[model samples]
Target: MDLYTFLYDLATGPLLWISFLTFIIGSLFRAGLYIMASRKMDKVTHEHFSLKYVFLGLVRWILPINRSVKKNPVFTILGYIFHICLIVVPIWYVGHISLWEDSRFGWTWTAIPDEWADYMTLTFLAIAVFFLLRRIFSKDIRLISTFSDYLLLVVTALPFLTGYFLSHGTLENVSFFGENMELIHMLCGELMLILIPFTKLSHFILFFFSRGATAVEFGRRGYSV
Candidate 1:
């Protein structure tokens, strides 16, 4: 009947089920395709670990995933910070932290607390937004930016902004718009989870594509080998 009740319903009922199913299906589909594609690509015996790097079955991902981006240390580190915070904060937030603690490897983390969560979320969201805007407004990035690239950022960013505002009760009160903001935020969040494994965001899950691609191209061209 009210905003909180509406959001509570979406968060608890249909959206949760749909989100879970979508995540499962989407993850499997993306991982399956990536495996098949990597296998199809010509192999190099010189490849380290003697594996197809299925889903970027590489060492960087095996580690901190920032190794491959060493060429640009600042950007890479910031990227890592942004990603870890983006993921860790939400999972550890008061809203989801208990479920995560119960269901996920007995894992526990210190959350930023509610108001601070809003602050951190807004700060990180701003950084991500700035990065996206930088890519958009710059001539070089604009040229290199694919439609999927921009689209991915759009999908990823909207939830962050909306959720941050919702959590803060700033731009959109928890009771506003029939609780549409919360539903919109949760649905977008679900969409992002379902979409992540398939998109370039998959890079986080599969950085080996870039490394393997780089290795093959360079070796074939007699460049960096």
Candidate 2:
């Protein structure tokens, strides 16, 4: 096979599977490590843990009922929008749903309209740029930011950008590094999945545990987090 076909097959087949498996296994391993460390270093957190407090904490933060939300309403709203679009658009896009239906499992689900997916993708990209600017311009945030922080933002945004291009045929006639836009999109998505477990994106899995533990600790003292 030629290079393009080879790359396309690799991206859609083995590499894709490897990325998914790595994400799942790595996330579980990280979670296991966190549990072990927490149990060993902070016995009190578990000893006094309350499921009620954990649930409450998750609800408070998940909604806009927290102090942080109150203090930074704009940022909070943008964050929610970004996350929602980030999650919803990918899972609900017509193209993605079709792929699922065509897969060996033949899973199928209703998808959002193509127009809606387009709008959401644009919104996601806009918010990603906003976040990058915030990190660069906000003095306090900048002070705490590292190279990895900026890199993660770019990594997170690239798949969406490339996907948008692929969907709209934005660069269909152009080839970069001997690869088409679809290949780039696939690679970016796979790279993101691979990185999620190792990067701050792992918060997708760890957020509940960390937030719940904090809530329990504070709740035991008659406080809210």
What are the RMSD figures for all models against the true structure?
Answer: 4.9, 1.5
Clashes of each: 0, 0
Candidate 1's TM-score: 0.70
> What digit string (tens of lDDT, one per residue) describes model 1 on residues 48-110?
322334333344444465345667666676676677768766776876666567753566677
Candidate 1: where is the Cα deviation over 4 Å? 1-11, 45-71, 98-112, 172-178, 208-225
Pairs of residues at least 3 apart in sequence or in different chains that clash in candidate 2: none
Instruction: Report lDDT (CA) for all predictions.
Output: 0.67, 0.92
Error of 2 at 65 (Å): 1.0
Tell me the tens digit of each residue's lDDT in model 2 across 1-225: 999899999999999899989999999998999999999987999999889999999999899889988899999999999999999998999998888899997999889998999999999999999999999999999999999999999999999999999888887666672348888889999999999999999999899889999999999989865
Task: In angstroms, give how far residue 128 of model 2 lies from its true place.
Answer: 0.4
